[model samples]
Target chain A: MRRAGVLALVVTTLAVAAALDTPAASAAASRLAWLVPVALGAVTLGTRPGALVALLAVSFRAPDILAGVERDGLTAVTFDAAGDAVVLLAAAVMTGSLAAAARLQRRRYEALGAVQRVLAIEAPLERTLRRVIACLDWRLGCAALTLTLRDGDAVATASAGCSALAASGNRDPVTREVLRSGRIVYLADAGGQPRPRRVLGAPLTAAGVTIGALVAERTGELSPPERETLVMLAAHVGLGLENARLAAMNRRAASELDTKIAAATHRLAEADRAKSAIVALASHELRTPLAALLGFSELLATLDFARDEVRRLAGIVRRETARLARLVDDVLDLSRIERGLPVPLGPRRVAVAAALEAAVEIFAGVDADGTGRRFAIECEAALPRVVADPDALDRIVKNLIANAVKYSPPGSPVGITARAVEGAVEVTVADAGRGIAPEARARVFEPYYRAPDVVRGVPGTGLGLAVVKALVEAHGGTITLDSAPGAGTRVTFRLPIAREASSAAPVD
Target chain B: MLAALGALAGAAAVLGGHGLLPPRAAALIAVAAMNAAFIATALAWAGAPGAGAVAAGLVLAASGAAAGHPAGAIAYLALPAWLASLARGGRLVGLGLGARPPAPALLAGAALGVGLIAHLALTVSRTRGYGFALGPPSVVLSSLAYDVGVNVPCAECFLRGALFNRAQRRWSLHGAMALAVALGLARYLADPLLPHASEVLAGAVFYVALLGMGNCWLFWRWGSLVPGTLSGILLFEGYRLLVVS
Candidate 1:
């Protein structure tokens, strides 16, 4: 629209100058006024067109110059005409140069605005790519435009204004050169069937990686502004592509966050439910033993009872109190471990054989009924002493022996074995009893998790194995349990040998 | 105890001179009384020392204004009170001096409309032969400077910042709004230009009261004195532009 206004202005100015050139209307002052339109034309239309208008104005003044020659002389008329020509040419040159500079600045501003608009588009990458291609095609007057994104061993192409120019393979020579050199490449003519007369390729790089290429084709050599604009457009396209990728990643992260929140909420609810169950069960378990102790104590205080009855009730109270103490201790131990407090470890060199014998002796003393529960101990002679916390080791061995005896049937044998192997001490506890179910074996070491089948028959807090596992791991050891329903269970653990033992041994 | 003294001073200013007191004196009395009410309410409800200091500041400003002090002198009189209040180390929200996320577009549109209406009203008064003209450049400049630097801040701080916030907490919203209206109308009681019981007097009172209520609502909504002060300055400048002669 602006270009047409300038054209109309140029035409009107020329016609007015021509009308004023008539012999009846001729005046020297009016002739001088003709310079105004010539200057205007130069500023609006630039050097060449402005010079043409100036020439036309000079021609229109020829008749007056002839008349001047008649009135004065040829020499004077020649001087006047030469001076007029010089003034007109000067106006054209100066105004034309200024106009060209202004045009270049305006084009740069427009290019920046277009790039901003392209970059501001918040859409999927494919949609943004198509919009950018369309913008470039319209702004640069490209016959066709294509953007090729390189994925691993694959290329995805988006085209505007031409489908035949779509990339047929993972590579195009122009695009390849631009991507490899990280520079703009131009082809005078695309040398292929249905080729464009000119093509420009620029690498779309982001974060030091050439993610894609922008290719534009037209039917003539691109001007410098056009080439520069294409380069600017390619840079904006790279940024827009990066933004799209980041947006996609953000969306994925949000979805993942939602999933994690849901899972955490579920786990919290499950924990709350488990806590309620533990409270109910623990209260019932405590109340039952308390009722017996209270009832028997009340009878002893208020009524005369036989000596045998008194002794039996006293024994029952003693057992119940011991059970309550054990339960409290287990609860406190697990709480301390979960709170991440440091567990005390008194490290010293201790013989594994002596630890085993001591645990077995304690077990024998505790088996007051003496239903023939037996332990088979096997230890390698001359085994190097392991550096350990003695009390912790004693707890580990005693807990294993107690578990074995508690789970096995009366008269069944429990086995304890220890040996030094490959810079470590390995221990195994085997029991012939109703083994843990395959599904329950994995969870036996979980705090407060009792086997459903044995919980009703056995008197235990389900913390024995959990405590065992924790102590073993705290001492830089690994523990594993192998068991199946109706099959005997085997528990094995290994602890690294004391550093001094390994260092002191001579090389064989 | 300070609030009681401020209230007594306000009562003396309003009731002592009967109909002979100047309009400015009556306005100062109303400002002092409102400040006293606010301080009493805040002390009873929250025991906030900031409220006491703000009340003291308003009383000082009233005293200065009653003595025909310049706007800058009055502001200086109020500065110590503001400092004392700030040193109490409590949230300023209870005093309506904090920002809330009110709709910006709505506030801006309302401010523009209020400015235009004020200008139009002054122009109409000029056309009605009330003698309005653009004054000398000095008069215009001084009026703008005083409105921005003193009058808008003082009026907004007393009415919306302290009184409205305390009233809202002490009474129901409607009751608080009623208190604001009553205090606003009291400013016109001693004006000699509009004689007592005249229709013009009643109209002025109603208009001023409405302005006060609207600004209080703005303060409550935005939880800040800023919008009210900004609107007050705009209206003051517009009125000055139209009728400063």
Candidate 2:
């Protein structure tokens, strides 16, 4: 581009030199030669270069045009030479002006496209604001820029190539005025002043309401067209900021959805594990009793025997049949518990010692396998009467004693202790039996859960302890188990003490 | 808007030149029509539909009266002296009649008004042939009554009471104040009394804008129109004492 300007300069200078050297008649024709360089420079190089060439042409042509004027007061040749000079200058100016306007229009469209590209994507607010500043600095040639937005009651600021605080903190009075007045404020220092800059501040408005402000500083005069561009850009910037905030909100909602899905997957994995353990324990415990009842009844029906032999076989069949019924009942209760149904209860005040003795007697007789169980019962004197259904409390105690008797060796004493502690009646059943491992302690209350090493040898369903825990909790009480493998297990439960004996109403 | 003002001013000049009316009466009618133009615009902007007819009647009355009977020419002056009666509990009280403005606000307004008058009186321009208008005490007092009673209340009604009240809801305090100042300058532009010289016109703009901005602040700070009206009365009274024509 500079090379074109230099070529224009040489041609324009040569044209003037020719006009000065030629005769008066021919010099007028030569003066028009400068038009060629002006037209070519404007088309190829740009506006300023073409206009500069015009000034140089007119200056070189000046002397010849004036020489005739001093010799002969206003001759026609001088008038003709001057008219040609005017036409040359006018041509240069007109071409340059048109070129300058076209260049400005293209720059404006490019700047708008740059701003729209940053706003089209959903991005963070800080990223969006930084791009806005970068867009103005790169496209508008702003030496410094500051964008301030109102975040609730506070102002949030972004700066490019300038101190954010200086512009936002009233270092530029025009910025404050623009924010307060919602108008464009322009300030240009006089030309003679040192380090002069033009500062422009415009309101950033959304929906005809001002939400923030933008300030731009550059080393030039503020053109009316640039001011208009700022006004339109400010509106786009406000909407861009709103879009960024929405993106942040969407990200948070997505994160919450991911967390919920993870929780549901974990619950499903736990349920699958529980189902596998139930299948293994239930098949063995149910089949053992069924095989015993089937063999004894078949033997009695098929063979003729003495009366005593027949009676003994009949006793074996009745014992196995009863065990089968118990197992079926336990399976039904476990199913109901797994479905999250609350245990039904009927409540009345019952003497704590009396309830324990009755539960003990029920289990003290010969077991279903014709095995006798040794038991011990201990109660603190003056133990408070507890508000409970007599039948539910009896079943709770019976389940715990039964779990201990099943796990204990033959004739091992199962101890039952009852006392009033912390405004409640506490009962504990302990057995000197093969104890539960520490790993299985946490899930002992879970229905149908059994130790992998212990369930194959045990001759009962793994539902006794879980049923006892639920029945205790339904009476507004708590139950805890303490055990270690190869040691012994102790299960304790507490129910709130009754205010008056037998005064509590029945369960709903 | 400028074309509308130019048309009204040009109408009087053409009428006077064609001897359709005596020159002084025509000039008086033209000034009245210019003043009425501002009033008509304000009323119409406020959604009152009858402003144009009222403005026309005012000009017609000014046209019929002779120049020597200045009061007769502006016979509307008779009602201005009592217009203060409507100001105390005005019908427009529904629009931001805030707590009674503190006494200090009135004092500050008077000080500003006095200060503005001091600047105008001390800086009389010789090149523009501008100075204080002189007349008998009766004429001066009558004009002062019009300034205090009619003009102050009317300007306060539209600029601070109507426009500022609505604009502040959508703009910042300074934004609303700036609009009042800009509208005040436009009102001067439509007036025939505004001088044609560029420097005098600039000075008039500076003072009018300053007065308008200050009055907007006064009303916005207290949410009431009384202090601004008081300041306006003082400023225009001062303006009357220092007029060029």
Residues A1-508, model 2: lDDT tens digits = 6686677667766765566555563663566567777766665566656765665555455445544554565788878877877777688778877776676678777877887787776665667778778887777777678887776677777778753325445565666787789888866531211123556788887667677888887653355677677767777787666656666777889989889889989877876776676676678778887998888888887889899999888877776786677667667766777798876667887887988887787677555445566789999999878888786787788788888887878778899999999989999999999898888888878776777767667755568777877778889999999888878899999999887645545432
Cα misplacement distance, residue A359 of candidate 2 (Å): 4.5
CAPRI classification of candidate 1? incorrect
Interface Cα RMSD in Å, per prediction: 34.4, 19.8
Candidate 1 lDDT tens digits, A369-473: 588678889999887677777877887887788788888888788999999988779999999989999888989998777788886787666677888888888
Residue range B103-214, candidate 2, lDDT tens digits: 8878777776776666555444322335676767766766665465445655666677667765664455567778878887886665554567655575577578768877
**Candidate 1 positional error at B174, Å:** 82
Superposed Cα deviation of residue A387, candidate 2 (Å): 2.0
Candidate 1 on B1-245: residue-level lDDT in tens? 65565565566565656765675566555545544454444433334565555545565554455346444333433533452355345444444443343678347536743844453454345333233467776566656654554455555555666666556544444566678667656644543323464433533553455467667666545555666766766766665665423
Best by TM-score: 2
lDDT of 1 at A330: 59
Task: Candidate 2: give the TM-score of chain A.
Answer: 0.67
Candidate 1 stretches with Cα past 4 Å from truth are A1-197, A202-212, A218-236, A284-319, A347-391, A401-413, A432-442, A450-462, A485-488, A495-508, B1-245
lDDT, residue A42, candidate 1: 73
What are the chain A TM-scores of the candidates, in order?
Answer: 0.57, 0.67
Candidates in order have lDDT scores of 0.66, 0.68
